[model samples]
Target: MDWIQGFLVFLSGICALLFLFRKFFFKSKLANKKGCDHNCDCH
Candidate 1:
């Protein structure tokens, strides 16, 4: 249906925005840090 296609497109747009935000806006925990333990995401 047309609504299904529109919903898919909206979800894809949201995913794209999230990807962009994660790529450029958010900082990675692996950078410029010291004494990282195995429990952290830096591993």
Candidate 2:
């Protein structure tokens, strides 16, 4: 039904948003010991 389709779309959108947030806002497992925002010679 139309409701089912809408629900699926909403769920997919939520998942996509969470994935994006985790990627940009969270540190990656592959990063070195220094991390991203840590003080270093990054500049």
The list of candidate 1 runs beyond 4 A from truth reads 27-43
lDDT of 2 by residue, 1-43 (tens): 9999999999999999999988754444424455646553334
For all predicted structures, in order, the TM-scores are 0.58, 0.60
Which residue pairs of candidate 1 clash? none
Q: Model 2: which residue pairs collide?
A: none
Q: How would you encode candidate 1's per-residue C-alpha lDDT over 1-43 as one tens digit per residue?
A: 9999999999999999999888653345344354555644553
Pick the lDDT winner: 2
Question: Cα lDDT for residue 31, model 2?
Answer: 48
Cα RMSD of all models vs. native, in order, equals: 4.7, 5.1
Q: Among all windows of ten consecutive residues in candidate 1, which has the lowest summed lDDT?
A: 25-34
